[model samples]
Target: MKAPRAVIFVSLFLLTFQSKAQTKFDHSIWDQILLLNVTKDGKVNYGGFMKDSSQLYEYFTLLSQNPPTEQWSKEEKLAYWINAYNAYTIKLVIDSYPISSIKDIKDPWNKKFFKINGEWYSLNDLEHKILRKMNDPRIHFAINCASFSCPVVWNRAYTGANVESALENQTKKFINDPLRNTITEDVVSVSKIFSWYKKDFKIDGKNVVDFINKYATTKIINQSKKGYKTYDWSLNE
Candidate 1:
C-alpha cells in the first residue's frame, strides 16, 4: 500500500510540473542568449551565439514542442511568432557561419528549415504569411534580417505583456535611428523596407510620410523628396 502511494505521489508531481511548463512559453533561454551575445546598439556576435549554440537548440526545442494554441491570447501568439522568426534567423546565420552575407545562401528567406508543432516554415512564411497578415506594420522593425541595413535585433525577448510596447519602441528607434533612416524637416531618406512595404505604412488613409512622422524625430514635409538608401547586405555580426 505504501509503495502504491509513493508511486502516485511521484506521478502527480511530474504531471504538475508538466502542466506548469506548458502553461506559458518560456523565452528566458533565448533572452539570456541575446543578452550574452547581442549589443545594445543591435550588433550581434555570431561567434558568441555559435559557442552557445546548445542553448539556442534547447530554446528551439521548447518552441517546437509548444507552438501557440487557440487558448493563447492574441498578444501571446504574436509575440511567440515574432520571437520565433528572429531566433530562427539567428540560427540560420550561425549555421551558415563565415558567410559574408545572408544573401550568399540561395533563396535564404524562402528555404524552409525550421519546424513548429511538427510543421515546417521559412522566414518568408513568418514575415509574409503570418506576421504581415496580422496587420501590424510595426512588425517590420521588430523582425531582423541579419543584414546591416535591417533593423537591429533587440537584445531582449518579446513577451506577450511587452510585445505592444516593444513594437512601439522598436518602430520609434528604427525610424529615428540616423543610420537606418535620415529624417529631416526637408527630406526623408529611409530604408528600402519603406519602399518594399509602402502599403503597410499607409494605414487608414495615411501616406508613408505620415507614418514616418509618427515616430520620426524630425518630421518630413509632405512634398519633401523621398529616396531610398542603397541597402547593404553585409552580415550584421
Candidate 2:
C-alpha cells in the first residue's frame, strides 16, 4: 500500500534535519585539548598531557559514545574518524608514557581499543577500513602517526565545516615544508608516507611526483631522483 503524501514529506524533512545535526558535531573539547598539548612545531608534550589526562579520557569517552551515524555527511564522518585515530594514538602513548616509540608497543596499530557505533576498532581499522576507503589522499597529511616523519599533528580539531579547507591547507603545508618534502628544480625528496601510500596519490592519471608538484611551491623540472626519507619512528616528542 502507498503511504500518504504528507507522511512521506514529513519523513524526508526529518531525515534531512537528522543529517544536518550529524554534521554539527561539537569538536571544541578536542580542539582545546590539542591546543594545550600539541606545539607549534607539532611536537607533543606527553609530560604535560599526562598531567591533564582527564581531558583526554573525556574526549575519548565522548567519541566512543557518540559515533557518527549513516545520516552524517562524508566530511563529518572523515573528520570524526581522523580525530579518533589521533586521539586514540595519544592515549596509547600516554598509557605507556616514557616510551621511545609507538613501535615499542606490540602491534600498536592492530591493538583493538576504540569502540565506535557499538564495534571495537583498531588504529589499522580506522586508517585502512575507514579513512583510506574514503579515497582522499590528503588524509595522509591530516592523520598523524605520532612520529617524526609522519605529518605534523595539527593544533586544531577537524570539523565537518572546516575539513575541506583544513585538508587542503595541510596538504600544502606538508608539501612545502622543507622538513617533510624537499623539492627543487631537479630532485624531489619526499617522506616515506608518499612511498607507503603510493596508490592513494595517483589521481586522474597523476603519479606521486605529479601529486607533489601540485602543492609544492618549488616545481620539479626533471623528476630525476626520488628518494624516500627514512621514517623516524621515535616519538614526536
Candidate 3:
C-alpha cells in the first residue's frame, strides 16, 4: 500500500527545504568570534580567543559539516575556504598559545589540524592545493597567516554574497597600507608575499607591477625598482 500522491509530494518538498537550509552554512558564530577577539586594525587577541574557545570549536564543527560541493557557487566556495583557513589558523595559534610565531610549532602548515567533509587537511593543502587553485590572487590578502607582515584578518565574516567586494577591498587596503608596502613612482618595497607568489598577481600576461598598480594608490612606474621587505613572522597579537 503506497502512500497517497499528496503525501509523497509533501515529503519531497520538506526534504528539499531541509537540504537547502543545511547547505547555507551560517557564519554568525565565526563573525561574533572575530568581533570579540580581533581589533579593527586586524590584531588578534589570542588570550581572548583562548578564553572563548568553545565558540571557535562550534564554528569549526559547522565548517566540517558544510564543506563545499560542486553545487556551491564560485563565491560560496571562495568564502567558505577563506574563512576556514583564517579561523583554523587562529585555532592553531591558540592551541599552541604563548608562541612567538606560528613557525614555532613544528611543521605547522603541514599538520592536519582540521577536517572538511570528513577528509583531513593541513594548512598547506588548503592554501596551495585548494585556495590557490581557485585562481583569485586577492585570496593572498584575505587569508591571514597570523603574522605581522601578512595581511591583517578582516574583523568580519565573509558571505558568498559579499565575498567579491570583500576581496576587492582587502586587496586595495593591503596595497595602500604604508606599513605593508611603500609605493613610489620610481620604486617600490612591497611585502614578500608579492615575491613569493608573484606569479599569482601577474594576470592576463601583465607583470606584477600591473597588479600592484591596480590597488596601490601611488602607482609604480613601468620601470620602477622593486624589492621585497623582510617578512615579520611574529604573532599579530
**Which candidate leads in TM-score?**
3
TM-score of each: 0.89, 0.90, 0.94
Give the Å error, residue 62, model 1: 0.8
Instruction: Evaluate residue 86 in candidate 3 and report its C-alpha lDDT on the 0 to 100 scale.
Output: 96
Tens-digit lDDT string for candidate 3 (126-153):
9999999999999999999999999999
lDDT of 1 by residue, 38-132 (tens): 99999999999999999999999989989887667777878899999999999899888889999998899999999988999999999999999
What residue runs in model 3 are displaced by over 4 Å at the alpha carbon?
1-5
CA error at residue 163 for candidate 3, angstroms: 0.7
Where does candidate 3 have its weakest 10-residue lDDT segment? Answer: 17-26
Query: Cα miss at 3, model 3 (Å)?
Result: 5.0
Model 1 lDDT, full chain set = 0.90
| Cα lDDT tens digits for candidate 2, 84-193 | 99999998888888899999888999999768768988999999998999999999999988888888999999999899999999999999988878887666788988
Q: Candidate 1 has what TM-score? A: 0.89
User: Could you tally the backbone clashes for each prediction?
Assistant: 0, 0, 0
What local distance difference test score does each model get?
0.90, 0.88, 0.91
